[model samples]
Target: MEPVTTGLIYAAAMAAIATARPKWEPNRGNERQYVLRPADISPLSDFGIADAAVYPVSAAQFPSGVDRIVSELNGYGKFGGDWNGEGALAPTAESVKEAIDFIRAFPAGLALPSPTISVGGEIGFYWSSAAGYVDLQIESLGHASLYIRNRKTGQDRFDDDIDWRTVGRQWYQEKLSILQDPLQIAA
Candidate 1:
């Protein structure tokens, strides 16, 4: 092959590789996001799918709180096309695991509330419960946030750190279970 023709072929191959490669950009909190084709994450190991202790949450059915959240997670970077122009990263396995753990621990006796779920930034999820009007933040790599309104005052408080066993249990047992129950009001 002529030297010039060989050089041209090499350039073409390099260009093809570059175009096919996923674009990596910095996402929330110093993490990197690959803005590329979405991966199929259907058979997640966690979310109680393999565990007998908790009921499995699947992404097969559309619009279910759990399903929607899972779907968003699986399509994190691909869904919104470099969302917010920051190139949002996909949810980490840890974050997804944390979310599932929280849901699996839902008190069996109480009616599970349906949540409006969405991916926040890259490493976490936002869940809004219509029943008690509660907002839940599930963080994979950092602290999670939760806000519950004081029934009487109707004011909102934000807590970045939540103790699932103590404060969480208190909210579940003391306030959310009973309608119009006063929030403990984390100070």
Candidate 2:
């Protein structure tokens, strides 16, 4: 076969493989359709809030009650108070609120311990929200890590590290529209 024909065949095959599988489409219309079990809510109240405002909780508090709550509610393991590294809980409403509170309380900034998987460096907490489940994107020395937590399971199955210089510049430009003062950048 000619080289051009072979290339055409390969491209066709790649497209077929890419579209053949059913995509995992999340239901963004109504969330109630996915019911939360009673067991899920029980732990939320039990989670101790003692030092939740503090990021990178001491080793003594590893797998804190808050972590347990996050795990039980989301059906996954959470790194509770740790933020620098792998986090114990997925970014849920509760978890995001906790993170926000921590950030607000420590405006000066804080060090988040490395989580489960090392990204070869550290990351600074920036913003978090629930996209599908919990979405946390942190900025580090010169890179950014995007973490998406599972909604029902509270698991971080999707974590990607990107070069800040390449992606962040574009992202910042787009995000600036949402801010009142685009010139004001957060650390």
Candidate 3:
């Protein structure tokens, strides 16, 4: 299916889910979101589907930025040699999947990060705030680089060959806090 069609379908499904379940509580303390209670007869349970599971879909599960990332990834995935008209290489399927997985793991509450495709066929997620910015570039599935700068402290840090697989939500929560609240001190 075309990427736009797929995205539309996903959006329609999410809309249906939201309509069936029209309750959204604030994030409060924890980043997780609960459905409160499932509709006894929502559209999701139609078509004779028995025992339709209504799992809690956290913001992290399908962050608001996922659509842009997926769209860019699909477009980039179809690129061939010289896709950029400058002899740029196409991103491998592995790299695309890696990028998807990494973004899918983002914790809830952080603002939507802008996504971009590099001439090197790599995917990057960037976040910026009044105080600083965080750049996460995915070279492949388990390999990438992270650059963070704090304008308040004039400190910069970069790490190579990062294994995002093991980085938990707490780690993202801490780093993304810079974007969430620049005035707050890093704990």
Best by lDDT: 3
Q: Model 1, poorest ten-residue lDDT window?
A: 18-27
Best by TM-score: 3
Off by over 4 Å in 2: 1-123, 126-141, 152-155, 168-187
Q: State every prediction's TM-score relative to the real structure.
A: 0.41, 0.21, 0.58
Candidate 2 per-residue C-alpha lDDT over 53-158 given as tens digits, one digit per residue, 9 for 90 to 100? 2233333334433343333434322323443455533334443343333333321112222222223222234323232322334444334455544433455554
Which ranges of candidate 1 are over 4 A from the true structure?
A: 1-89, 115-119, 122-132, 140-143, 150-152, 165-170, 177-187
Candidate 2 residue 14 Cα shift, in angstroms, is 52
Residue lDDT tens for model 1, 30-106 = 23323322342244466634322333332242243434444444554344434555665444556656665665455
- Model 3 gets an lDDT of 0.70
lDDT of 1: 0.48
**Between the candidate structures 2 and 3, which one is better when assessed by lDDT?**
3
Q: What TM-score number comes out for model 1?
A: 0.41
If the candidates were sorted by their TM-score against the true structure, best first, what order would they fall in? 3, 1, 2
Cα shift from native, residue 180, model 2 (Å): 20
RMSD to truth, every model: 23.6, 21.4, 14.9
- In terms of lDDT, the poorest run of 10 residues in model 3 is 18-27
Per-model lDDT: 0.48, 0.37, 0.70
